[model samples]
Target: MARNSYTIGIVLIGVAIILLLGKLGVIHFIASFFWPLVLLIPGLLFHMLFFNRTLPSGVLVPGGILTTYALMFFYCNLFGWGAMSYLWPGFILGVAIGLYELHLFDRNTHRGVWIAAMILGAISVVFFVITLLFKLGVYVIALVLVLAGAALIFRRPRSW
Candidate 1:
């Protein structure tokens, strides 16, 4: 239809202008500040493709990984690189989450693999949280007290 063609043409021209502006540094916000979008776009594209069935479910692994890592990098950029030491495990956990998602979506998935992925993802998070807490100077004594309290609350005493 003529109307649809006109709309498409207008969109193309808009894209051309934006690209030109980016090239000319007239859109410094895109070139400098929104760089994380580079990672985010493809990561989201991967998921969209998977959901649309354009790509196999296996793609979820990389998609989740890229998206999570991009998020982590964005977070680090906002805070500081020093947090990376504590947050490094999150990278692996992100992939694990993706793998888990793949397993959930794929009927032919091997349960063992997905179970391992979930376990690994959990380990990554737990390890990082403990590390972060320690780095923040949560005392060993405090941890011991908390653990002892939890044990007392959860475990019933045996009758003699």
Candidate 2:
């Protein structure tokens, strides 16, 4: 099939580049960095297959989650494992994204699906922000507390 050949050609090109890079001695230390692409390629391929009508649409959820998780792993791989502390919310967000994609593209989507996606996505965003602030250190919390106290102390009494 044309699609299969196209995928294979792209894969061959990728391998060729990696080999070239390896021969140049630039890939030895960074070979592990490419491992996540293994996940990303198949994940993206599933979505593409769905679009190309070669696979059932049900694969979208797995595809989206895999793609999101692969990116998350890639981020951690590049930034260090400590990045996972604040990036943990990506797990929930990935599922929420898949749900959103399903609800948006599926004609028979249920109202509950949208509601679930909104809830999960909002929680993930909030958690990520809070965790990131925490990782940024105690200064942010102290500043918030100081601002709140100042606001409270400066409040004027309401006229009766």
Candidate 3:
């Protein structure tokens, strides 16, 4: 009976601590900031397994992908989700990174994998450029116009 009472008391204390932490927002804080670790841990495990020879190089594909995505998520979480509009290209880059890793680490990798990785990487770059231009293009255009106007005003031939 004494052992049972002690166990019950310990369990109640543990529950109370958990509840207090949750109420204090500590649990939410950890969950929000460190949730990317859920993806990162498995990704790292895959890499470690490959390095240890417990898994084949094929695992690197998902490993690279997950790690990249986890990093991207962490960035968004730290900054803001709005940044994802510009960072969406990172998704394509993640696959490209995975394929590149496979090409680099796999002994039996083919030329096709390298080509695919390059194509995807190029696509990601293109998307990033387009997104940036779409988002900040107006500011750039405004600056250019202002500069052109200043140059015209300062020019010697002010007749026109």
Best by TM-score: 3
Q: Report the number of backbone clashes for model 1.
A: 0
Residue 75 of candidate 3: its Cα lDDT? 98
- RMSD values for the candidates in order, in angstroms, are 7.6, 8.0, 3.5
- Please, what are the lDDT tens digits per residue for candidate 1 over residues 85-112? 8998987788787888788888798888
Candidate 3 C-alpha lDDT tens digits along 1-160: 9999999999999999999999999999999999999999998999999999999999998999999999999999999999999999999999999999999988699999999999999999999999999999999899999999999789868675
Ranked by TM-score, the better of candidates 1 and 3 is 3
Please count the clashing residue pairs in each candidate, in the order shown: 0, 0, 0
Q: Provide the TM-score for each candidate, comma-separated.
A: 0.66, 0.68, 0.83
Clashing pairs in 2: none
List the global CA lDDT of all models.
Answer: 0.85, 0.88, 0.95
Q: Model 1 segments beyond 4 Å from truth? A: 1-32, 139-160
Model 3 spans with C-alpha error above 4 angstroms: 1-7, 142-160
In model 1, what lDDT does residue 81 have? 82
Task: Give candidate 3's TM-score.
Answer: 0.83
